[model samples]
Target chain A: MSDLKIIKLVKNFVGMDRPAVNNVNLKINSGELVAFLGPSGCGKTTILKMITGLFAPDNGDIVLDNKSLLPIPTEKRGVVMVFQNYLLFPYMNVNENVGFALKMKGIDKNVIEKKVREMLDLVKLPDIGFRRPKQLSGGQQQRVALARALIASPRLLLLDEPLSNLDAHLRDEMRDLIVTIQKELNVTTIFVTHDQEEAVLLADKIALIFDGELQNYTSPKNYYEQPKNIKAAKFFGGVNFIKSKKINNEFISDIGKINYVGENINDLNDEINITVRPENIKLSKTNDFDHNSFKGNIKSIIFSGTHTRYKIIINNLELECSLQSLGIKNINQGDEIFVHLPKDKIWGMND
Target chain B: MGGERLKIILSLTPPLLIIITLFFGGIFYGFLQSLGYQPAIGKYDINFSAYYNVMFSERYSKLFWTGLGLNLWVSFASTFLAAVFALFGALAIRKTFFAKTVCNFIYSLNLPMPHLVVAVGMIFVFSQSGLLARFASQLGLINSPGDFPVLVRDKYGFGIILAYIWKEAAFFFIILMSVLQSLGENFEELAQSLGANRWQRFRYVILPLVMPNLFSASIIVFAFSFGAYEVPALLGVIYPQMLPVMAFEFFLNPDLNARSEGMALSIIIALIVMILVVFYFWLTQAKIRKD
Candidate 1:
């Protein structure tokens, strides 16, 4: 296990005024798998490369286990990265590829062979010691790359979109394998990806970066439920942003006024923006006439696999709603409906 | 279907007939002449006398043996040296854009320059009274041009080997650059992440991936250097001449019997090149199997 601290990291490329990685700071705890989640070109992969010493940071230090890694070369930094393409050396067979690092360190032949076999078994590929990389399938090659990376016992393991090249089914399997192996070894790992779902599924903590800046660093649930800004919120999924006014003690929107349920609502500007996730807006066939309930017509119904999404129109305002299709009757478009915006799930933010 | 098949066959017949008639016909006629069956001289009887005279005759044996040895040395040395220089040159300039342009221009500048021109350039640059010798004398490294070391037209064929390397290294550089560009930096980056340093990445990963291409390129350089006539003709000494130069000299003789001997020497050179090519393929295939 290793703790990593990235302090004020900056990297400026030529012919660009804006730095690729701007003054980014992160503290990764020991034995934690943190996912740097964002859209593409959000400086997530740049940060990973800087930590691995592939790209030099213009101004900052990466301290691993309280020692600065700037002075160490890439090979001596003990940071291993599994690239997006799973760059297994095409010329080497499975066992030789896995044993390459130990051989580089001048380990004994018998011991390296034993360790290679052990790593292969750990990756659940015990029978492919003699096969070339081309002979293996995508998932199998991924395992070989992972096995090769892990055999070195690196201080920090970095995976850069490790499953982006695999098919959907193989991506799931590779994700589970990586999570299990990370847990079993208790190795501190950083996974850089643009897929928010993958981050939410596998990361202990997700650091959301946007436009070369760190937006939020917290648990996956908090990243999804309590995004700090509108950009971070939209990255998780779709959200209905409402322009509201803080009148008296209530927040007034086109949908209606609701009691403020947030800690920073009082200190915020009179005009604010609030968001409610689509799934949180519940729908029913009959009106309960509650304060948060409003009569609306189902303008459209999109039948997805496991759930149905409805676009509801109430008082000339459109709102998105999602509900599970398992126990509900078939809700048709243009049907009269009632939407309940739960007071707890309606989140407010300052303009 | 029969008409379509006939059309395809007709489309291919011109090139195939040209190859079979012109190329193979010339090779067969040359082989027959080398075997001492020359219809031009009305010597229809086939004999091993020309090959024996070229290999072990009193008047020509010394030149023949030394020419064979020098041909092997010059071809092997130049090919190996050119490949090494080109590989290092390509690896060094592949990263930086400005360096790539400048280094690429300097290395590939010779690619279009003819080998005859480069051999002449070698004389102008490396001869005792050449530009380098004059510059060295002015710098006080030598007292005069006559004090400069012999390089061009030397007995050991160093000047010929140098000329070949100068011309062929560009060819090698072009081949290696394309290969290295296609390969990209991912493998080296991954190797570095796996705790292999710069030299290790090159030795274990880069060298193996590019070896087959480099080997094939070297074969072309070696074969061309062995069978070519102009460079050695311009830069080599009369004694201990290269095989092609010696064979051309035999052809220049007035005796018709000597032309058969020249054909035998040319055939021997071709056989050597073919054997080396087959051996190279076998070796590379064995390396692939081992991997």
Candidate 2:
């Protein structure tokens, strides 16, 4: 029963020059689900390990439940981890696996059985008590790992990409399952995942990390709308940008003069990297559209099920735009079209 | 799939043939000889006399049971000690590079030591006025070699157990290290995050998960030590006439009949180890359920 606080945690892998985790400090309040979202080798998993005391920090302290956890071993910290592989203890059956912590506590068998069954029911795997981990599907095994962690009534539950191993459809379902389950259990949890969408969908707070540094930690809305830096904007908005100069109150790039949207983050330093959204940059047959125009040759048009993305090379600048084409867009490759980009649709980063 | 199956069977043929010749053929021959229906002798005496003599001779009774008991005790005791050493060796290599390199080099040396060399090495290190006693005397820690104490050739099979542990622990360390490594860092992190203490994590996660391989390896080590001839003959002072030692002694007899009894004794020792292994399988299955 503790609120977890990490203060200036650093870990250096011996024999490796670069620090895997460099001076990471983050806090998870009680009953919150924060995600450590990063690509592989971003030190997200390593940070989780340090919190669980699986890896001792080369320096700094971890405070959990008003006590310094640096001196405490992992098992005594009251934090449970659900691994990416689900790690259900292959030699153990589901009941024993779920009730493992209680068994360690030397609890009565009857109570252990009761708690295990209750947890199994909570994970909606009520009939899987006698089955081994290998017998269960990836999703079901993930459920069991969750229940095992939750049944311990842990202070915090750390998930190291539990849904990554599942299939696409199953991954979606399990993401919802984890969120619903965490809300029901109200355990302060941090999920470590490389998948950006998984992090956005599952986390109340998304901490986007890159190269062992926290890029931005914010809610999903702010993360997309107002990115802190170029890395944040690039990852969250999925935008395409071109280096440009801010002269005559417009972005002069290879494409054309993109109308400068200066209402937000127009703080021009010396140079500007402006992003033209693929969706916002439109292509139409009308030559008279009152917008910055470029005569683009239709290079290619990819027809997705519900939408089409057009690749246009205008003035030797390849510009891509997504169209919500519902089965019809009288557009073909090698056709001439006018590309219209509104002033407000352009986002620029001061470099 | 069919071609793969064929390839697997074809690959297995050589090992299957070796198993048939070395294991089954030996067992079949022993069975025939023990029954006293020796085709080579041109005799088919339907009598339990050889069995009775092998089973109930006063020397056989005294030597076989005592040696069997001693072998069992030493094998188990040594395996336990080896397991402890392997655990320490594993933990030592868990995080530190220096400890890892030295421990690994020393432990890996165990498997490479031949029985002859191991026995000779034991003589050089553990015998009376050997390297240990010589060093102790020079250090002025002991008055004489007798005061240096009986480590090797000790009456309680302490010497055999020590040598067995020294050799087997290193050999088993490699196996144990692989098992621990294969489980990887994630599972331990999972256990700790689940609020499992170091002991609890080890007991609940690490031990339970790897127990299957560990138990199997332990039994293999057990059987190896039980039937081993060189170590017991050379270093075993607690029971000079240990089962394998007694078997060697009987086999060296001038009378051909005495050698046949020795084979029968060998057959009995093999059966006991096989039964013990079967029991181990049963025990492990139950443990798997509990896990």
| Best-matching candidate per TM-score | 1
Report the C-alpha lDDT of model 2 over A1-351, residue by residue, as the tens digit: 457777877788867677787767777788889999888988898888888777888987888878897887777777777877888887778998898888877789999999999998988999989997888988898899888988888888888888889999888888888889889888899999877788888888888888776777888766665566678877765556667776766667877676665566447754677666677777877686777777889999898867798889877878788888874558899999998867666666663
List, for all models, the DockQ compared with the true complex: 0.73, 0.55
Interface RMSD of 1: 1.3
**Where does candidate 1 clash, by residue pair?**
none
**Residue runs of model 2 more than 4 Å from their true location after superposition:** A1-10, A14-18, A23-30, A58-71, A106-108, A236-239, A247-263, A287-299, A313-316, A327-344, B1-46, B58-60, B138-140, B237-240, B255-257, B278-291
Give the TM-score comparing model 2 with the true structure, all chains together.
0.86
Model 1 Cα lDDT, one tens digit per residue, B183-287: 999899888988998889889999998998998999999999999999999999999999999889888989987888999999999999999999998998897
**How much is the lDDT of residue A63 in candidate 2?**
89
Per-residue error for A74 in candidate 1, Å, reads 0.7
- Candidate 1 C-alpha lDDT tens digits along A1-351: 499999999988887768888888889999999999988988999998888888999999999999999989899999999998888888788999999999889899999999999999989999999999988999999999999999999989999998888999999998999999999999999999999999989899999998888888999887556667788888888567777898887788887776667666667788888778998888888876465787889999888989888999988888888889889776789899888877778777773
- Provide a comma-separated list of chain B TM-scores, one per candidate: 0.93, 0.85
Candidate 2, after superposition: displacement of residue B105 in Å? 2.6
In candidate 2 the C-alpha lDDT for residue A220 amounts to: 76
